[model samples]
Target: MATLDGNLVSADDLLPLALTNLGHFTSMRVDADGSIRGLALHMERLVKDCKAVWGADLDTGRIREYVRQGLDGQSAPCVVRVTVYDPKVDMGHPADADEPHVMVSVRGAGAMPPQPLRAMSIPYERDLPEVKHVGLFGVLHARRAAQLAGFDDALFVGRDGHVSEGGTWNVGFVDESGTVVWPQAPVLPGVTMALLQQHAEHRIATVTVEQAKGMTAAFATNTSIGVRVITAIDETELPDDHPVLSQLRETYLSIPGETL
Candidate 1:
């Protein structure tokens, strides 16, 4: 189900986004009680991205209202995505657009696959690494190429040959010393990653592909998956069941969700 600006959305309301695909969004898993983990982070992301993408200010309270209206008091766990875009804005004159409208879409919750993921590192970088924008063509293309190459997903490597992130997720590594290491590169600051960092002892450093390969284990973090072990990158194999990775996942899931 979907709503636009707290009202039921129609096809006309989505035409601009479908055509231009210029917007930013944040996804979250909402419990049956309308609560979500890192809810404030998500709101901050939306507000920040709105300013970056459209130079507009967004109210978190209004976003919460729209989300609740979209959920419609359903007592079932689901995934919710709030998209901010302006239907009246065309690519030719985006700067002339007014405050962006919000679109709240709800769907059934999802979990990571039981099997560990194998990723292929590719030289690619998102246009705006900071915003969770609707520009996903490059991301999906990379993922598809990795899948065709017998891998689960694509791990993005910047031009500098430093490992940055995975398709639709942030990547974390566990070194031989059991230290959690996050790549110090330009990538989306994912909510799940932020939540894990708050509770996990971690350090940020520039991790090249070779450095990542030397790590004992790796994992992917996103709103939908929370945390999932990455068993391999390129030809290098990592421990799928590393105790440190398990502890990090547990620490992430243990975070309490805030009520909407």
Candidate 2:
């Protein structure tokens, strides 16, 4: 299901987004009971990105209503993506656009793959590493190149050789001592990563690709896939089922979710 400002979306309403593609969005997994993990962080991210991209203030209450309307009283867990854009905005004159509108799209929830992912590190960086904007050409291109090269996903490493993040998720490492280590780099502050940081004993540091390979274990975190093991980076193989990493995944999922 899809909704624009709490109403069923029409093709005409999406022309601007399709044409100009100037927007920011946030996706969250909504449980059967209409609750979400890190719900506040998701909402906060939307508001922050909205302001950063369009200099507009978004009403979180209205966003929640639009999302609820998109859910349409469904009783199954699903993935809900709330996109902020202005249909009135045209590619030629985006600066004159009005306040952004909320587009809520719903789909069936997804789970982590049964097998651990193998990622290849690529030297890439997003336009605005902090905001989760809609500019995904580079991200998708990198992922495609990695897949063609016989890899599951792409892990972004900066030109300076510091590992930043994954294609659509935050990458974290488990040291030999069982401590979680997050790379200190310019990347999107993922809600799932934030939640994990609150509950897991972790530290942040600048981690290069070489250093990451030496780590005992690694994992990826995102809203859809709460925590997924990363078994290999480039040609270096790591443990797929570290006990600490497994415990971290269980801990993240066991946390209570909040109502939309």
Worst 10 residues of 2 by lDDT: 107-116
Instruction: List the candidate 2 regions with Cα displacement exceeding 4 Å.
Output: 73-75, 112-114
User: TM-score for every candidate vs. truth?
Assistant: 0.96, 0.97
Q: Per-residue lDDT for 137-222 in model 1, tens only?
A: 99999999999999999999999999999999999999888999999999999999999999999999999999999999999998
How does residue 115 of candidate 1 score in lDDT? 61
> What are the Cα lDDT values of the candidates?
0.91, 0.91
* Residues 12-41, model 2: lDDT tens digits: 999889888799999998876778999999
